[model samples]
Target: MIWNLSICFMSFIFLFLTSIFLMFLGVVFIFYDLCYFIEWELLMLNSSSIVMTLIFDWMSLIFMGFVLFISSLIILYSDEYMHGDFNIDRFIILVLMFVLSMMFLIISPNLISILLGWDGLGLVSYCLVIYYQNVKSYNAGMLTALSNRVGDVALLMAIAWMLNFGSWNYIYYVSVFNDSFEMRVIGMLVLLAAMTKSAQVPFSSWLPAAMAAPTPVSALVHSSTLVTAGVYLLIRFNSIICDNCLGQFLLLFSGLTMFMAGLGANFEYDLKKIIALSTLSQLGLMMSILSMGYAKLAYFHLLTHALFKALLFMCAGSIIHNMKNSQDIRYMGNLVLHMPLTSICFNVSNLALCGMPFLAGFYSKDLILEVVSLSYLNMFSFFLYFFSTGLTVCYSLRLVYYSMTGDFNCLSFHPLHDEGWIMLGGMLILMVMAVFGGSLLSWILFPSPIIISLPMSLKLLALFVSLIGGFLGYELSKFSLSYDLQSLRYYLTVSFLGSMWFMPMISTYGVNYYPLIVGLKYYKVFDQGWSEDFGGQKIYNSSVEYSQYMQWWQDNDLKIYLISFMFWIIILFMFMVI
Candidate 1:
């Protein structure tokens, strides 16, 4: 306990101090349009300069401050949550490593340096996910690691492609190489990397799977830092990606991811997975807006979402801790009666997630929706945005109804205590931010108000979705009491939504099944049969046959050797005659 406290104290001090410094930089950059750019020529490879550059513009500074701030708070929370665990030190170390990698990713403009941070996040997150050393944790860790590796591989390819530009400093080429074929390839590769890191579309399975990690890890990693890295990267590379065909594809897929995750969350039973899906939905929101050429707005939402989403995870952590590790919302009921503080925190975060009028999430989400509303979009993108917004409300209210309002449904007595200062401390800090972060950020980010002209119907669209979703969420959770919707007609629809539209299956077995079958055939044919039969066994048989032939040289009689030599000569002569 003492060691954990000491580490948390030290981390808090360091992160707070650094956050202040970065905030100062952000302010200066905002006012003066100044960037603190530093470059070091690390080495030269094939006369192509491999340099590391750090760019501290307002965006980087502010985002870094937000990440470090949330990380420090999460560390404080972990002290209580991970108490009595022998691997607590390892947990703290991994969390710090994640933060360090995020910082590395945030400041560096060079693709090579960013990979160092990018791969660091993947490796450390895998370690953290399986920190409990359970089978579920192991599986989750493998999925998380492998899914992110696709991004890592994409990043490596992007780096290799960027080598044609003579420097790995991609920010320099973001504007100038907009039309180059190599740059287009690099842009597409970077987008792929971002999609995986952000858990957009097909790579979305790993985000929910990764909830097997400790809650503090989830609060910091999935909710805030690791997941947002992709959106941040795109914001940096927006110059090259915003006008391309790939952007349209990204727009389409990201919208689908948002809707899919929101719909899936409505059917999800596990509390942590529900929150994880919410994170995925929000990630999709950010990516979709970015695809539509609103990078700053996407980044703004990323920051606000981090603030409240981290609190949401912490509140879920508190509830999970109080419920004796029960993460199933079906097993929880009327938590507000027992854990009032946690309930409040959870409610605030959820409302923020739903983009309640004045909360942190509202500023960014509303701006995103307005921008999206005004943009030139087809019906597909339009439906995805509006309907996904409703689904967000549907799931948020469903979670509230299941866990906060019904009777306490636990099988055993579990005392819910709100006096864990370490736990509540983090929640309280973020709750305040979740309450006020939107207004604060809006004031800072947009000194000039953004003006949008929309029809009254379109302006009320978000409100309509929220109201309808809330009503449906309440009604649906109580549907079993009054309806027989579980009949054969509805079974497939329920199963599909309940199974997250089989995304997990598609991302997992659907992707790996054929490759695995092919591997098995290779094992059977080459590894087991052909390789041994032709490779090793054939060599051995040939050697044996040579040995048998050479046995003629060891014949007991000189006459035998003379006969053999005569036979060999006769064969040679026959060949010559032919």
Candidate 2:
């Protein structure tokens, strides 16, 4: 008990202090737009400057505060949740490192400095994901690491390409960069980096697979910090990206990602995995909206979603802990009767996730839908946004029905007390935010409410989607439940949704298959066969033959030397006569 509690207690105190300091910074930056660059000119070439630079601005300070606040709560929650673990200290260290890496990412305005935080995030997250000594954790860590490395490579390329500008600092150039070809390339690469980090579209498989990590990692990684890194990059680069053709493509793909994740959540049965997919879906929402030239709104949603979603993960974690690590929803039901507080927190977060009235998600989500409705978007994007909204409601309700209501589904009963106040303590604070954070942020972010001129029918569209989705979710899960979903007629459709439209296969095998085969072929042909036969083996045989000939000539050294000398003399005399 002391082992676990002491780490959490110390971490919470440090983080709490850090959060307060960052909050003070955020307030200062917000009022004054604090912008400064500390430059160390290590070396200067004829036309370029290489320097270490750090930027302080409202975005960095505010984001840093939010990150510290959430991280502190998560660390505190892990005291009870991670109790009795053999390597709890290692977990605590990784979590703190995760927080530090994120702070680096938030503060840097230079691409080179950003990579420091970016790569740290990838490496630390991979370590945390594989913290458990299990095959599943190992595979998940590899997938997570490799998927993120694609982004790291992209960022490095962007950094190299940005050398044309002679400065690593990009904040100054964002407004005008879109006019140049090189900058456009950087923008596209930046978008790619963000997509992989946020698990947008084809890169989405790793987010759910990452659920193999401990839930505290999931709360921080998925809900707020790691996944949001890409969105933050896009938010910073919005000026350049929003004007590019790639931004339009981002809109299309992000919509697809949102719809895909929402649909996948509906078919998913694993409780933690379902919530992981929900996080993926919301990431799509943020990215797609950012692509539509609403970067601030997207950022606003990012903040509120982080609050509620972290709480959501904590609630789910508590349930899993109480259930002795059974994540299958089929084994859960009527949890509210036993774990009332957790159930309340879970329901509140779920409602907020669905954008229910006055909740944290409602503020940002409702605004997004309204603004998206008024924006001049294509049909595909419009449909995806609205339909995906409903799917969010559908999955939230389905999760509620299967796991929070109905009879006790588990074969054996355990004490369902919300006895872990250490875990619940963190959740309680987040719950307050989940209930009111949206309204508070909305007031601060948008001093005056945004007004949209839409017809009555269009204004009600969001409400309609939520109602229909909620009803369908309840009916399908309760009254009209059928076990024949695996019948011949329904099997294919069920399998498609169940498998997340086969995205896992496409992402895992589709991306890796050809490269792996090419690697094997190279190994066989060059390393084992052709290189040895034509290069090393041939050279060795020639050397052996020459050595043998030299040995034989040496055996008859006097005669051989005399004959060779006479032939050379005759040739030289003939040439002189000619």
Candidate 3:
């Protein structure tokens, strides 16, 4: 206990200090207009060499600082969150390794190094998801790992294609070869990898499924580490994707992802999965703008979204912990009466998520909406973006109504109170950031404010939809005993929307259905039927029978010795006669 607690304390201090230090370096790097690289040769072949390279610049440094800072607070949060678990030490180590892996991904411009971090995130996340040691956790972990493995395969292909360039540092060469078929293919593969990581469209099921993990891991994964890795990569490769066909492709799917995820979250009853789906929706918004050539705005949203989302997850974790680990929001109502502090933090973070005026999400989300309006894109995409924006607000308000308002529906003797001060301490810190992170990030990221000229109708459109969505969210949740639930009348539509448009089904059983069936057939035909006669088991039996037959010769060796002597004497007599 003492050792584990010490590890948490020590890590918080070390990482907290490092985050501040790196933040200072980030500002300095930006001020000086400087970048540095360190290369250590890992392998060399006649002309082509594989090198582990590290880059130091404002972007990587600042991103790393935020990641570590959140990780520090999460470490503090988890110390109390996983208090009595026998494997608390292991949990801490995994989280620390997760942070390190992210640092690896953030600092390296090399595809090879990024793969190290990418695969690490996938693997560590699987371990974290299954940390609970239950069937659901195991299944969710498999889904998460397999989904991420698709991205890994895509990245590996990208790396293989990069072999044509003689160096893996695409940062120095991608723009030069932007028109080349090779670079285009690499961009597509990178986008595919990004899609899987970011949980866009069909690959999105795993993000919500991963809610089976601990909330601290969810906070980290959703906020800064796993999901955002894809968006960050796209931001770096914005040069190649701008105005390209791949950008259009990303726009279509990201818009769909944003729309679908928001709709799904509104239908979801599980508290953590609702939050997880919201993360997916936010990632889609980021990707959609990046596709439209606003990488800075995407990155701006990424940083701000991280702050509130992390706070939101912490508050949810606290609620779940006190609610007897019940994640069902149906069991939670009138939480404001019992846990006033948490309710304050929860609503504030949710409002930030809804892009409430002057809040963290507002600065980024509103600016993104305005920028999309300014750009000339297809009408279909524009509709998806605005409607998805409304859905985001709709779900935020719906979740608030279901989980925070109404009557308390939990067990009569529920643990309906706030958590320890340690947990609240982390929540309070992030809550403050959720309020101010957007403006701070906007100032630091863009020295000069972005100005957009728009008509009054266009400018007020976001606000208008937000108000409408809020009304719908509340009205949809308000039910009397005689009220007809639309879900009952439209079962298929509700199920389709609620289940992430059958994406989980498609990603899980749908993709592997045929392969699993084929494996079953092979097992019946080869292992059970034909293999008995043709495979190793038959060979083993034949060898044993042959050995038994040879054993008789050994047993009769003494008797055969006398017969052999007589035969030899007769053969000698015949030879003499000849």
Candidate 4:
């Protein structure tokens, strides 16, 4: 007990020290804002000379706070959660590496540094996902690595294009090429990279697969770190995306992803998988908000989402841990009775996630809706926002009902106790923020000067819609929805067909990978021809065949060696003569 208490105390000390360092970093970032506002060209240029200059910006500070907060929570949770687990040292190392990479990623001032951090985060995440190295975890890690490679390639292409056609410095590159066609292309490519990284739309399947990993990894990656990379990219290049077609594309794609992921979450039985789907949906909503020229709103959502989502995931982790690693929601029921503290934390986070009034999600989600409503690009975007909100409520309620409220039926699984005080302490901190985040935002975070006033009516309307939607979902949840196999089949077929068409469009236009199809055909032909000529199965069967052939060759080896040597000598002599 003394050792355990000491460990928990040490973890808290580490987190507190880290938070102080991050706060100092945030203060340093304010100086960059000053330099940018003053138009100090010399300061701007020389700022690139020093690595510390990367720390100077409001955006970087905001994201850095996000990284620090989420990472600290995860670390604290892991202190107890991973107490007796083997490979604890490796887990802690990977967790620290993940946090360091994300810190560097948000603060990097140049594309090269950003990519370095980006790849580092990907590498560390891959390590964490397959920490156990079981077959399923290994396969999940491989898929994650491949998807991240795709995102990295797209990001590299965009960086290359920017270097060739625009400036190389982060702010300069965005400002100098703000109105150019190449900038638009770069913006679109960056969006594609972000989509893949954030698990948007067709690229979203890997996030659920990632649930095969440990819950701590899921909490870290999905809740706060890797999944937010795309949003960070967008936020970094907000100026470039604001006046381009890429922004419109993001709006549409994000809205669609939100709706689709929400629908999928309603059908998911796995607790972590449902939370994974929620992450995708919320990220889509964030992207859509960013698309509508509301960087502040998007950032607001990002901050709130990180807090509540991390809390939810950690609480889910605690539950899973209690249940001896069972992830199926069907096996979980009356958990509130079994684990009251976790139940309260989970419910609080879920309420925030559902955008209940006065919660963190409520403020940011309403703000996003308000921004979209005011912009009102078209009927499609408007209706998409409405539908997405309704679906968000539907899935949020679905998760809460399925996981917490059902009758306890599984006797084979023993009732487990709550997490340690340290775990509960971390959760309680997040829960307080989740409940009071909106008030904090309004009272402190919003711009003081108020250069532009938001639409009051639109804000009110969005809040009303969100509240009504949640109520509707609660009512709908009173009766179980009947499952129709035929309807499910039809929906699956349509989704698959739509994705088939949609993938090509997004790849060709959004991602700018039109040559992929041609490359696929060429690869197919190459594979087929290789298989036909090689007698594919015979190679594995014929290790001794090579030995026999080698023996036969030995009989003629002297003659063949002489001929080969002479041929090489002749070629060399001819080259020397020439």
Clashes of each: 0, 0, 0, 2
lDDT of candidate 2 over 316-378, digit per residue (tens) = 899988888899998899999999999999999999999999999999999999999999988
Question: Compared to the true structure, candidate 2 yields what TM-score?
Answer: 0.89
TM for candidate 4 is 0.79
Give residue 30's lDDT in candidate 2 (0 to 100).
73
Could you tell me which residue pairs clash in candidate 4? 29-56, 29-57
Whole-model lDDT values for every prediction: 0.88, 0.89, 0.90, 0.75
lDDT of 4 by residue, 1-578 (tens): 45554554565577557765755665455534532222222343544632333644666765676677777777778878888875666677778788888887887767767888899988988888888779988977877787778889998998888776544556656767678788777877888888888877678766777788778778888766899988988887888887867778788788888877776666567899888888988998988888877877787788888889989989998998887888887777888888889999999898788788788888788666765666657988887787778777776776677668877646776657788887888889889988986667554456453333567765566556666666766676567555464697655644443243244345335543457776777777766656644767457558678888877887778899678879999999999999
Q: What TM-score would every model get versus the actual structure?
A: 0.91, 0.89, 0.89, 0.79
Cα lDDT over the full model 2: 0.89
Model 3 Cα lDDT, one tens digit per residue, 1-578: 99989989999899989998998899888878889998998899998777788999999999999999999999999999999888898999999999999999999889989999999999999999999999999999999999889999999999999999988888888788888889999999999999999999889999998998899999999999999999999898887887479999899999999999989888888999899989998999999999988988898899899999999999999998888888898888989988999999999999999999999999999999999889998899999988888888888888888888888896674657888988988899898889988887777788875789999999999999999888888888885224245756555656778899998998878889989999999999989879888888789999999988777766779678668778999999999999
Of the candidates numbered 2 and 4, which has the greater lDDT value?
Answer: 2
Task: Write candidate 1's Cα lDDT for 270-307 as tens digits.
Answer: 99999999898999999988988888899889989999
> Roughly what TM-score does model 1 have, to 2 decimal places?
0.91
Q: Model 1, residue 99: displacement in angstroms?
A: 0.6
Q: How far is candidate 4 from the true structure (C-alpha RMSD, Å)?
A: 8.2
Q: 231 in model 2: Cα distance from truth in Å? A: 0.1
On TM-score, the candidate that comes out on top is 1
* 3 against 4, candidate with superior TM-score: 3
Ranking by lDDT: 3, 2, 1, 4
